[model samples]
Every structure is written in structure tokens, then in C-alpha cells.
Target: MTTSPLAASTVTADMVWIPGGTYLMGADDQYPEEAPAHPVTVPGFWIDRHPVTNRDFDDFVRATGYRTLAERTPERGAPGAAAALHVPGSAVFVAPDPSAGAHLDDLSRWWRYVPGADWRHPGGPGSSAAAIPDHPVVHLAWADVAAFAMLTGKHVPTEAEWEFAARGGLDGATYAWGEEFTADGVHLANTWQGEFPVENTAADGFVGTSPVGVFPPNGHGLYDMIGNVWEWTADWYAGHEPPRGCCAVRDPRGGHQAGSRDAAHPEDPVPRKVLKGGSHLCAPNYCRRYRPAARMPHAVDTSTSNLGFRCVVRPGHPAEGDRAATG
Candidate 1:
């Protein structure tokens, strides 16, 4: 999976050494937000081959006695806290019946803020993550993800770093594996098969999150880089910034915190972070973001059943030294 000439001394069995280089960061043909494709360079780093699974997260929780944000009740008087936030819960996807004349535009028809719905209880009260130990752990907010990374001595990948790794050395390609969405009519990633929100044909053999590494890995040996679940990156949610002059930006990050505020509702200013990789909920008819250049914005304090993340260990970082010693 090594692509560049640079060598990595801290490669591990569970992590892939992404030989970093420059690549087109965004897409100009797909969604408008993904337009203005620009060139960006990243340093070589080690990234988890797959998104953090339930078993991996469970180990961290058991060792550190960590309770995720979704598991804690939010303060009623906290700024921007709504009545719904007073309860311990996370957003869960519940498909609406087409027979009920479900509105396609109203996401509330499909997403519900369920009480008691956290990573441990993905389906609210009775569901358990232990039953699907191999699946990517969802319902994690930014704070929870940061805490996990800190405990593991790893760091969340920035938007540039994530996109570079997702490309898997195939710069400017539409999908992670190549331009084709599928190979010989076989699904390569877990994605929606039918009309979104109401119908899911499950052609990929999954109605929700699938077990990690079930699909073929990308050129970098990174699994689930394009689907299964959207992954959080360490960047604020401002649109792509075009490169200046003719030089490709090196190790570019994201916008400032003040600029990351969601402008959709001026009355409620909540900051958002960039989320990469489309989830199993992605479909051609709806969110066709199951590509290397695809990205979305999500509030920092919010968590969803379809949102998850992976960790990265940059060269010379403490995590890199830890991996080198452990490996």
C-alpha cells in the first residue's frame, strides 16, 4: 500500500502507512460545495486501516471508564441547549413508511432524537453495540472522539489528510478505488440501494452500518474510506479554499472557529466540523457523496447513528513513537 518513496518506521499491523504527497483536494463536477478543486500536499502518516469499531471503542471505554457525550445528560441552562438536549440521547435513523406520504425534504421524517440512544444502545433502549462488535461505533460527538484519540495517543486526521488518504494515491479519481462505483456489478462499499429515507433495497447486504473491512480496501489498504459511515475530521466546516498562485498548499488545515458557525440560522449559531465519507445512507438519488472528494458539515456537539471516525498517527508525534515501541 506504500505509494511514495518516503519510508515509515512506525507502521503497525492495524494501521497503514500512507505515503503522503500532493493531490486534487476537491471535485469540480459533482456538488457545488465540492467544486473549485485544488491541489494540496500532506506529510506521510499512519492511519487506522478501518474506522474505529465497537470492540475497539469498548476497550477504550472499559480501560478509561469513559462515558461518551451522548451518554450524559446536557445541562438545561447550557448555551444553545434545547429541551431535547436535557435528555441523554443521540440522533437515530428511523425510516418512514412510504405509505404515510413521507416528505423527502423533511429529514425529521427519518431522523429522530431518541432518548437513551448512545453508542452502547444504538437503537435507543434495548439495542446493544456488543451484538455488532465489528461495526463502526457511532453516536460519538467531537468531544468524545477527541477524548478517545487523546487516550490512544493518536489524533484525528484533518480534512486534507483524510482526503489524501481516502484517495489512496489515486489522485483526482472520483471514487476511492477508481472512477467506477462498482466493479463487475458487485458492490465495493456499503451504501443505500434504493430511494433514500423510505426504501433501502440493501443491495450491498446492509440496511445500516456494516462490519468494518467487509469491503475491499482502497489503494492504501484503507477500508470503508468511502462508505459505511461518515467520518469526522479535525477541521472546521468552511468550504474549500482555493490554492494561491501556482504552488500546492502544504499540510493545509481548515478555517477558523468563528467562520465555522452554521449560517443557515442566524438566530442559532452552532459551529460545525467537516465530516468526510458518505455513510450507508448515501444513495445516487439522495446523498451521492460516496466519493473521495465528498464531504459534509455537522455540528460539533451532535452525534448520529451514521457518523463515526478513525484515528491517525503523524510522524514524529507521540502516537508515532508509541506505535514504534509497541510494534
Candidate 2:
């Protein structure tokens, strides 16, 4: 594969070359969004070895003076603008009161829109990334990830590309590493250990986002592909159509913008993008979406404490050509 121009300049030592191939892109029996398991083939590309870290994002912000969506206050006149969304903040995972009995259906029981919960201040104003520089940078919306990608001459991976690399050549495996969630009673990924929201045993040695690369790498030598954080993808969130009997698709992109709106919040009109790999909040009793095939729809303008992204370098892209010209 021809190398991207940014590969030489911006591709850090933590980036790993994913030799791509065909794979079953979705799960047949899982969530409806990931159903109709289809075959998809993707070209080889380089992906970050782990989710973008606080240090990496800090460097980007320092160089470009960019502001994340969570750091910006929402305009009042926008369609479906709620009073609660007027202030600048991101959704933070707040543990529910153990005595009150956790409500699984009510997400508000555990999620709160803190006033100053951006990437730098993950838990609001007082919190800082100073102590967790190596942790994955969270609270990034789709536009924030896009800005970073443009600045670095990289692009966000499409759903197909992300899943292909995440599989690590293990076709139809339940997890990135294998069928088992753990081996010999050892946790593989940084998923929730106990009951959701109320209790966390931290069996994986972390209650929240752990430092990237603390866990074992997948077969492709990629870190945190399944958990630790939910990663942004280029694909717009749309349900997959069932494939024609036993046929594979070539480099399938996600749905169009018009169809990417969330059905539950149709009045809002903010388009949603696909988020993959689950997060530290995922648990067996709650969100069992830590698998490679799992996917979630996140609004483009809505950032959360568990959301972040990594960049990908595709071979012979026009963006790379543009970067080369400017350089």
C-alpha cells in the first residue's frame, strides 16, 4: 500500500500498521444495530496503538489553539435547544447511590451534565488531567476529533475499517483477543467489574479510564481496542441492511447524513455518529458492548467523559496530497 504523506511526519511510534483484510463486519445475534452480519473488506492502514491520550491532545491544542465542543457554550436559537444545554459541559458518569438501588433504564441516574466537564477537567472544574496525563483523553465530540485529524493530516477510521482492525484477523470472534472475556479469571480489557454505576470491583485494576497500554495488546499489536473508552468513528449512525445471501461488500461506508438522526430524539435534529469499542462503563449486567462488533450512536455535538478518538492514516488519500503540498 502507498503510504500517506502524514505517515512519515505525524504517525507516532505508538501507531501500528494494520494489514487489512476481509471480515464479518457485524454480529448476527447481537444488538439490532450490529445485526445482519455482513462481510466487508478494507485496505491496509495505520491506526493509533491506543486511544489518543491527554498528553497527545494537549500537544495538539497547544499548537493549534483549538477548543473542544464540550468547552463551548451552545447557541440559544438552535433548533431543539434545551435550557439545560445552554451551558458548556460534557456528560460525566456519576455513580448512583448504592442505597437507592441503581436504575438500569434511567441513564440520568448515573449520567450528569456537569458545568465544566471538558476533556481537561473530566470531572468538572476542579478535576484536571495533571495526574492522568497518560490516560485516554475524553469528552471529545465528533467535530473535535475531526479538527484534530485535519491538524495531524490523518482521518477518523470508518466503521468498516475500525472493525476490521479491531478484529485483529480473528474472524467472528466474540472479543478482540478471543471468545472468552477473561482467561484464567483474569480480566482482559478495562470493563466494569461489578454491578453497573453503583458498584465497581475494578477487577481490571481500574475504576475509570486507565493509562493506555496497561493491558495486553490484541493480535494486531493494538491496545484498548475493546474497552477503556468509546472511540469515535467516521461513520454516521444507521442500521445496517441485511446483505444479499452470502455476498461480501467492498469498503462499505456508513449511512448518509439525512438518515443518521436519532429516532428517539428526532426533534433535536443533531446527527449522530457511530461510537465503537464500548467503554469502562460497560458491564455484563448493563452494557455488554465491549466486543469488537458492538456499536453505539453518539450525537455529533454531545461529548461525554467516556468518549474519545484515535486517528488513522489511509494509503494514497487526497488529504495526504494536500498536506504534502502545504509542507
Candidate 3:
């Protein structure tokens, strides 16, 4: 969580270590809740080589005067129910004119949701940041990324610190860099290439959200984690708990699933809270769930613009304990 030099000059003060080994965390065969694929390890840390922009959350809401929860509170169901149903605030996709042959199962016909939007009105209220202040800093949650990682001392990386910084030191690669979704074809990772909802041939040049670090930086140099928006972790959405069923990894990793409003519509009761990397409306022809064992619970009252967050520094605390790892 040293990431403070904000004002987005492409926000790269550079850190991205991520050495840590032993992977194969979960899901190798199209989601049965990422069955069987286990194994762990994780040690070395230090991430955020990118992501957490919008002038570094507007200098962390102007040096901790902070407000974002969509500027306090409003999204509580109906009358703009958090920017239209379960929230998707500041939304503004619309990119549909590949000769008008579009699709994406009515992503609200093209995303919309807007309500004075957040991340300082990303695509709403006449959008500002003066010109994409290097994007990536949407409407954060997950306790406002643990209160901006305790106001920059750092803390918020847990889901095993976001799957050990998205398994960037690769192991059972589905993509954190490996197992080829395309190499000679060149479409490394930004997802939704085309026909996922109908037509997205922007071909990774841009459709929305893609300014974090442009792309290419995993093997632990973490950048964009897995597609743009959808960061937030420090865990807590519990469902189908296993693999030592969780609890005790140390440092912010506190979650193990249990907030099932529908756990895949187990009859839709309306639960929420659980959102990891996988945004820019991920479209592997139908919400590829944004791997890292794919998850999406969402409901800690709700708020969106694709969701956002990033921060962590608990290796030993105070001044980041010489880069954390102290027990």
C-alpha cells in the first residue's frame, strides 16, 4: 500500500513484486465453484503496479476527507435503486454500432445506470477527471477498500491477498499469464473479444475501462488483476467453503462464504457481498465470471460503476513493516 503518488501520470511508481510460489488455487474446469483444483503457498507480496487511479482516488478523497459510498448514501432500492437495480452506478457502456448488429443481453440496452455517478462522476454528471485521469478507480466498496487500507498504511488484499496477487507467479494458469487464450492471435487479457453478448470487436483497443497499465505485466508484476473494474477483497461472501474451508491465512484474508441470497438463485432471496476482479462487463460469451476461481456475490447494500478497490500492507504494519511478513 505505498501507492500514494497520485495525480495519475500513468500512476506508476512501480512496485509489483509478487514472487511467492505454489499455485493451483481453484477452478480449472468451467466453474463447479472451481472444483478440485487446490494447492497453496503464497509468500512474497507487494502489488499495485497499476489500478487505483482516478488521481489515486482523488488523492484519497483529498487526503482523507473521504466520501465515496457513492458520496455517502443513496442506493437503497428503488427510485434509482442504486443507479437502477442492484446498482451499476456511473455506468455508460453504450458501444453498440458495429453496423448496429449488437448484443449483451440488454446490458440495460447498453449499460446506462448513471446517477451523478461515482469515482467523482466517471461517466455521469457530464463526466470529469478532466479526461480519464488515467481511469481505473471506479466506485469502490468492500469497506471502501478497508478504508483505503487504513488510510494508506495499507490493508485489503485477502482472498488470499486477491489470490496471491492473481497468481502472477503462475502455477495452474487459466490466465494470470499462461494457458494461451491467444498468443499468436494477440488478445492477452481484457476479455470480451466478440459475440459474448453479440459484438465487441473493439478488439482490446478500448470499449471502456482500460487505462490502468495498458496490459502485459503478470508473473507477479500485477496490473489490472483480470480485466478492469471489480477489485475489492478482504473477503466475506462465503459459499461452498472448502480447501481447508478457510479461516487463518493471516493479514486481512477474513472471509469464507455464507452470504447466499441465491448462491446461483437458490430461489433468489436477495443476498450480497463478494466481488473480485472481473469487470468492464466481462464477456466470454456470457459473463466468464472473471476467473481467480470466479465470484460475484454483491450486496453489502450495493453500489456500482463496476465496483473498485485496492490496497494492503499488513506484513508487519507501521510504515508497512519493512514490507510486511512478521506474524
Query: Local error of candidate 2 at 171, Å?
Result: 0.7
What is candidate 2's local distance difference test score?
0.83
Query: What's the C-alpha lDDT at position 278 in model 1?
Result: 97
- Ranking under TM-score, best-scoring first? 2, 1, 3
Tens digits of per-residue lDDT, candidate 2, 1-327, equal: 233223335566778898868888899787877897888878888899999999988887876778987888767754322355688777898898899886788988988878778999998899998779999999987778877787677888888888988888899998999999999998889999888879999988999999999988898999999899999988888898666667678777788777788776787677888899999999989899999999988778788888888888887773442221111
For residues 1-327, write the lDDT of model 1, one tens digit per residue. 112112232344699988878899999999888978998989998999999999988987877788988888877754423475588888999999878763667887898888899999988999999999999999999888876776676788888999999998889999998889999989999999988877899988999999999999999889999899999988887888898899999997787667786656555566778899999999888899999898887888899999999988887775421211111
lDDT of 1 at 109: 89
Please identify model 2 stretches exceeding 4 Å from their true place: 1-10, 77-85, 320-327
The lDDT of each candidate is: 0.84, 0.83, 0.61
- What is the TM-score of each predicted model, taking all chains together? 0.91, 0.92, 0.33
In the range 1-327, model 3's lDDT, one tens digit per residue, is 334433122213565556555555667587675565666555666667766788877777786576766655464553335533454354455555566555544656666656667777777788786478887777655556555665565555656667767767665677677776668887656667776544767677876677777877676677778877887665556553345655322333434344445465576544455566687668876788666667666655445666676664433345332121111
Off by over 4 Å in 1: 1-12, 77-85, 319-327
The predicted structure with the larger lDDT, 1 or 3, is 1
